[model samples]
Target: MMTQGTLVDATIIEAPSSTKNKEQQRDPEMHQTKKGNQWHFGMKAHIGVDAKSGLTHSLVTTAANEHDLNQLGNLLHGEEQFVSADAGYQGAPQREELAEVDVDWLIAERPAR
Candidate 1:
């Protein structure tokens, strides 16, 4: 019998939306594929990882070209109270988006220059 279990990687990543070309940047999928290479297709998968539980609260699979700040809103929309991510997720709009949802989002600041 073919075993088809609910393999929930939990952090697999967001799915894709369209084919990439020159004009388009981000897509519905989280990853993208490149051309010519053996393993092509480059994609970006937005993910929200819980620091303590390592649970994926939210995930968005957009094109690799998608901005972290742009996708930051998706993470904030999750039920998690606090979230952590790289500097790519830093910005004003993201903060406001989180605040709007009444979610206590805390993004660590980079050390002083």
Candidate 2:
């Protein structure tokens, strides 16, 4: 059964950066983004899973440069009692679009290096 708590995260779906296609250009829909010290080129797959059942409940795709937090609202089902996400989603609660959302934000803190 679906639960009221949702876990949200994103992964990069990498694509070749070479412009070898018929148009001799990289896919317009894909974009480049940096992670840590490496640069990734492609799209991002944002997913929301039911915390209890561990089943995916929502999904959104966007250019790799898009911030994970930008898709937070779309990943939610609007019935969540709480939302859990990684440090990438920091400041999500402060976003104007999500300011009125009445749910606990269990965003993780980045570990000290």
Candidate 3:
């Protein structure tokens, strides 16, 4: 339901972060790629999930190095409640994109690590 004067939107964005694999391995997940001895790939699949019902609405996948704000507009459309993301999404443009759509782009605050 659309609010009296509020806007709704939705989108899929990729949050790319590289994490070192703690486990030892010989063969990589894919043989076509190689990096010295142990092949590694960093990837983060950003998905749009329903905030109210806690359901995934859509998804966007990209390389681990891809920027989260790079694909913000891809998911903008009518009927979006809001956007929720991890600290990796704490960027400037992301909030602006959602603002253009008149939607609340909520970012999960990360504790100082």
lDDT of each: 0.48, 0.93, 0.47
Q: Pick the candidate with the highest lDDT.
A: 2
Residues 7-80, model 3: lDDT tens digits: 11222222222322567442232122132374335443555545566455456655544565665656443476
Give a tens-digit lDDT track for model 2, residues 1-113: 56589999999999989845697877888999999999999999999999989999999999999999999999999888999999999999999999999999999999999
Model 3 stretches with alpha carbons more than 4 Å out: 1-42, 92-99
- Give per-model TM-scores: 0.50, 0.93, 0.50
Alpha-carbon RMSD of each model: 10.2, 1.2, 9.6
Summed backbone clashes in each candidate are 24, 0, 4
Stretch of 10 with least lDDT, candidate 2: 18-27
Instruction: Write the residue-wise lDDT of candidate 1 on 1-113 in tens digits.
Output: 11111111112233434555577765434454432353334455666555555555667766554566666666543344445554444553346554665444355576677
In model 2, residue pairs whose N, Cα or C atoms come closer than 3 Å (at least 3 residues apart or on different chains), thus clashing, are none
Quote the positional error of residue 7 for candidate 1 in Å: 22
Model 3 scores a TM of 0.50
